[model samples]
Target: MAQPTAAESWSGGNEPMKAEYGKLMMWFFLVSDALTFTGFLTAYGFMRFGHEATWPIAEDVFTHFPGIEGDQPLLYVAFMTFVLIMSSVTMVIAVNAGHQLKKTAVAWWMIATIVGGFIFVGSQAWEWYHFIIGDKGGIELADGRVLKVAEAQTGEVLSLSQLVDGEAGHASNHLEKFSTGEVKTAFEANEGLVLQSPGKGHAQLTRTESLRLMQNAQVVQGANMKHNEYGQGQFANFFFFITGFHGFHVFSGVIFNIIIFYNVLLGTYERRKSYLMVEKVGLYWHFVDLVWVFVFTFFYLV
Candidate 1:
């Protein structure tokens, strides 16, 4: 048989899975990002389980709620998760509206999704603030163990400032200014306070032993790369790395949504006789929401 001409033999590349080029690229990006998140969560799981005896309890660590008098474990985190999930719902509606070529409906739904995104991002910021500032402070011993002050009888954790004479401001970094002598003085004056290690089965030390441990201890308030008032430093490190990374992705998605929303308002898709752009962005928004569900499970529920 005679060889076919090059032009006759040529055919456009296949559109695998019947996806448009842009949608396919987005899926590839999401898969890569998902792997990155999986690696991070896996590392966190190893560290937490390896030091199961000393790992901080999620409920105890995330007990703060805005404008609340006392600890409310995981309540605020649940709120954030709900908002993100609802945003995904709005994105679905927006995509459906685009499929029907209803420009006004698409615009309104896009706005709703954008609002939900803003709420979630703002809530995450509030959570980060509390995590970095800490609630009750602790003492880091020479061997890197952290011990919190609590009522000897009730075991209710107390802030270092509560034992001290003056009002301590809410500044997250203020505890760094307190001298060891000042901390020792506060500990001595509070007769009912004892040092307790954080963990599932950790024991509290007697007053005498706590005082002795204080002699070689450094005060730690809030969390940083080097010190954590909660428990092991690795917990804080992982918290910051994983959550901050996810937050960045959410922020980027919000910006992308905003651009799509503006285009929808301008009838750009209607003029093109296709709403493929809205569908593409919807895929991303849904992916972001799905990832948050896993994050919520790993960080809060697990």
Candidate 2:
């Protein structure tokens, strides 16, 4: 091959940019990944805005968790968000160490990043557990009403009549029992309860609760706990599909990081005299984190 002249080197280089071709490819991949995330987020916004009246308020919907009593709105997700963000920081440190050719430093940061990723996944699983299996679901009634039990000063869920549809000298109506067994019962039937707002209100029960209510004579005879009190069926569907897909990407990224971490320990990149592998995987990992940020903001925050 012919050597390039100094003029060619300064102008249109016979050489590539300071970054290798692999790094450039990683950039392209990240841009495309960003667009994919944007599409998902835009679709979410469109659907949510499209049904603003009926959409769930994220905080009210996700307030409680197992083993911890009382309202802790968005608590689980907030922890997951912090974990993922810290993992991103560790990943940056690893990338910096790669640039400095410090293999052990890179491995240390990568291990920390992996630990953060695992913690994030664990948090997500716990959140899902609360969502899928641990909520105390409830019901609605006719005459534009719904009933939830509430905690009275005595430490018990007050009858619907006590909370909103107060019987005497009350501004707002306390929750009223659907006379003659009209409202469906919740899971455990006696788990601690709180009355969510009416059908027009934003709280939601899970699929199981929805189905259970559907089968009940009260709801079947005619109560409004029908298809989706928490969110539209389409909304729930998209939420699961999009978020679950993004989570799978995070899982894959963790695996990729593990492989790269092993290679770094084995001196593979050192033998090549290039740290491009670490850099490339780092780009992918950051893309995963970026997607989660949008997911957290759009789905849980706003």
Candidate 3:
């Protein structure tokens, strides 16, 4: 057999690694997207480690569950991670079915994958809702430190309404904000409540020190780009940006899966005698799932 001429090689007759153009392009896109996520997670790691002492603990911040009361740290997030991973598993099955030309199996597995994507996205939205709403209100000092009101004996963080005597009027941001005078007055009246530092160690102050700190503090409830009740403002900022970005990717993958699913039902691939489109979307889905593993580890587990 004669080797191909240089002209033939240059004319795109040679395929690198025996991959088709579409598969290679999908790989390229995934590589670029992986880099983008790496950059964001790297920035997050630097900031988090730089302020490790004062940074919010993932468990403490994500303690809420849908129907359960009290703190269930890491449980709900674990569920979300499990669902996403299962979706990736279903994608694998769908791809395998496509390879075998089993149309019915492919369609069913794709539906399962789509449902899993929807569940994960919905769960993330719920998580974000709780994060923005915040668990307990706190006071932000002039130096940007947050001091939470907690029971002196139990160390349980308390909301502003819990510290105040009566109904705290709702503010525009859905969190009740009180004037400095009102907060001071309420603090002076409560002997059991103490101001606690937002560190991992959660340092607390005596009654005298708490009162002095309350004098110049401002009430902060919930989280936004500028303020966070949990801890540092940057924590909230990164949470919103990184998670929202990932969620958007998942949402886009779902849309892609739906389009491909419809095509499968219409026998588009059957007529062509190829299920390459299903395999392509499966690659994207797996990439999204793999990225989430890293995000989950860095943001929640670690």
- The best candidate by lDDT is 3
TM values, all candidates:
0.89, 0.70, 0.90
lDDT of each model, Cα atoms only? 0.85, 0.63, 0.86
Q: In model 2, which regions exceed 4 Å deviation?
A: 1-17, 65-67, 138-229
Better of 2 and 3 by TM-score: 3
Where model 3 places Cα greater than 4 Å from the true spot, the runs are 1-11, 165-181
Q: Report the C-alpha lDDT of model 1 over 129-174, residue by residue, as the tens digit.
A: 8888776677899889887878889887677776664453444323
Residue-level lDDT tens digits of model 2 in 1-302: 57778887778745456677778888988898789878888887898777665555677557654466556888877878888989999999999988889888999999999998888777776665445432323343343233334432233323323322334211112122333242334323534443433223434444454444434322211112233334343455566667778888888889999999999999998888777798899888888888888888888887
Clashing pairs in 3: none
Model 1 residue 251 CA deviation (Å) reads 0.3
Ranking by TM-score: 3, 1, 2
Candidate 2 structure, TM-score to reference:
0.70
lDDT by residue for model 3 over 1-302, one digit each (tens)?
46778898788767656787898899999999999999999999999889876788788788877877666899998999999999999999999999999999999999999999999999999989878886667788878887788889999776677677444322322355656677778888888888887767888889888888777788887889999988877999999999999999999999999999999999999888899999999999999999999999999988
Cα displacement (angstroms), candidate 1, residue 214, comes to 1.2
| Top-scoring candidate (TM-score) | 3
Root-mean-square deviation (CA) per prediction: 4.1, 8.9, 3.2
